[model samples]
Target: MIKRYSKSMKKRDILVIAPQPFFIERGTPIAIDLLVRNLDNFGYSIDILAMPIGVSPNYDRIKIHRSLNYLNAKELKPGFTLKKIILEVGMVIKFITLMSKCNYRVVHAVEESIFWALLFRPVYKYLLVYDMDSSLVEQMVNRFRWLKSIENRLESIESYVCLKSDAVIAVCNSLADKAAKAGSKNIHLLTDVANLREQANIECKEDLNEISQNNKIALYVGNLEAYQGVTLLYEAARLLQQDKVEICIIIIGGSESDVQYYQNKVNGDGLKNLKFLGSRPVGMLEHYLMQADILLSPRIEGSNTPMKVFNYMASARPIIATDLNTHSQILNNERALLVPPSSVAFVNGIKKIIENEDYAQRLGSAAKEYVFREHGIDQFRRRLQIAYDTLK
Candidate 1:
């Protein structure tokens, strides 16, 4: 029986198409790294075809092919950008050439790369695994308001990808539900973990007391997109200016332009409690997180949980996040303070965390425990294994 069962198992060769520049210490890239790392450990040979940017880390049984770089940009951030679209066209051509020559057991498409996988679906018999992080249509509409009229068309494309895929790896429950409704056969709700290998190793060079001027620090990580609720954070800071609490807002992430935009907004509002530390080294992230009295996730939209949320929970810092489904799924009143996406509510939440140290301590303790038990690397690996096993 063992011999017969073993006969069916063949060495797996997977082709992964990462739309974004690979090996970046960002949200989607980090998640992709975890998946690929786990698969490599299971003796799967992975060939990653990604944008010709980002650092490539060494991993056994893995090969990376970077697309031809036409643009001279050093970095490419997430979302729909002109350079990204241009690069994708080149990437798809390379993808086609690779698929024609290589024998892959499965094709793993990350986010927008699904369309490329779909383009070659008719020709290839390989299994398609969609690593669905966010709804492309939703993100497009959110970024470009004019695209709202064509939302249905975009969603139709999204539905097509889900229905065509053999397995859908959703980053959150909401995405899984959407995939289910779109007729996905195998939907795996594998959430993100706090993968901070580099960040954890960095030694702190600055003193927290000197950085915050002895004030209580509240940390906000991630990009400064409108959906990230950076505006709401600034609004809350303005409100906190008049309050008795001495909490300082330290934001870490964003392009120079985004940082300037928010800095001007904060200055115009006459708020002195906010500091925008734009695009710090990844190693510095843990240092700031460690010094923070509270971790802020004022995200106003999106379904998938932000990678920082897991990191925040693991930091044992009391979290103050919007009460929307995006955050409510991971956080509750016991583990975090859930507040509406409003300045007043956010101000109140901050006050609660600052004033009641006992409650905040309990909340932080609970959050850390929850992350260690549910959102660790082992759990992520096991879930990934189950999703792939079903395909076999």
Candidate 2:
């Protein structure tokens, strides 16, 4: 990791407690980088405490302080893990250490990290900002059967933080409504935006060239977590193969472990036509996107909008997404084909898009127009400023 912390910078007004790795090709980091950029524009000196995994974002006003990775591990994935539980304790200790060095006025924390910020609020007396990305309780219990014991207590803790935090900055309307249900009087909705262009140093078209253009390509770009609906997509792939559908569902992101695990599972099931390529750089995104006939955001769990939907809309590709609140908050019937998270539903949706070229093109065009008009860096910056303004 590149050390870029500078003592020359002025006093930091905010301490952004990001439990995820920073500057990585994933959801939370991308949003955090954007937050740093816009906060710099607004002249807020900030300190971000994150895991020791990701590369530096390299902004001037932002000084990054990573919590001790005691296990000497180099990478971390999304979701709740025992490793994360250990790291949270380290981060809380680090947060306490930083309180002695910097008198931060606001503490902006994402996900479950808000609990630590709240737990020590009386001592430090910082204005707490809960950056609600997703429902942490839902994320844990929906995925892991082992977390059933503490599920109710987890929900209670989420409600407690929402109620006590100085402000709640929700990522979507569904999350904002959730915060309201928990009695958070000061709630702000600051949604995510799309980064359409990639500053790619290396151009990659080797993988796309191998595929034949005989069948239409449907691309799914994101992590291969179960919550991301990769398993659902695997089932969809099988149904399509049985039905002799002529579309290819190309997966473009996952950790090495996830890729290997899913590939093994697919091989065991004898599923076909679902291609798995490990995570690609953000720069190669447009190159890969051009080869796609359709974009997908098939999240089976969580209410917050998937970060891919913004780019899916911005990519001008006809989208086929789950009809859950996760996608429907941003996508409607006219914008994209919203269907139930099922194999038959995906198969029919793919056929409908394939059969009607004009309709597909219209959906793509409408989505692009909507994304550019509503979800862009400008709006993200404006909403973020409004949230911070209240903290002042």
Residues 133-244 of candidate 2 have per-residue lDDT tens digits of 9998898898687889988888888898999998999999999998999999889888888766743455786655356345788899999888888887888889888888
lDDT of 1 at 257: 88
How high is each candidate's TM-score? 0.93, 0.93
List candidate 2 stretches off by more than 4 Å.
Answer: 1-10, 146-153, 198-202, 207-209, 267-272
The candidate scoring highest on lDDT is 1
Q: Please report how far candidate 1 places residue 129 from its true position, in Å.
A: 0.3
What CA RMSD would you report for each candidate?
Answer: 3.2, 3.6
Runs of candidate 1 with Cα error greater than 4 angstroms are: 1-12, 196-199, 264-270
Give a tens-digit lDDT track for model 1, residues 89-179: 8898888878777767788999999987877877977888999999888888988899999999888889989998989999998999999
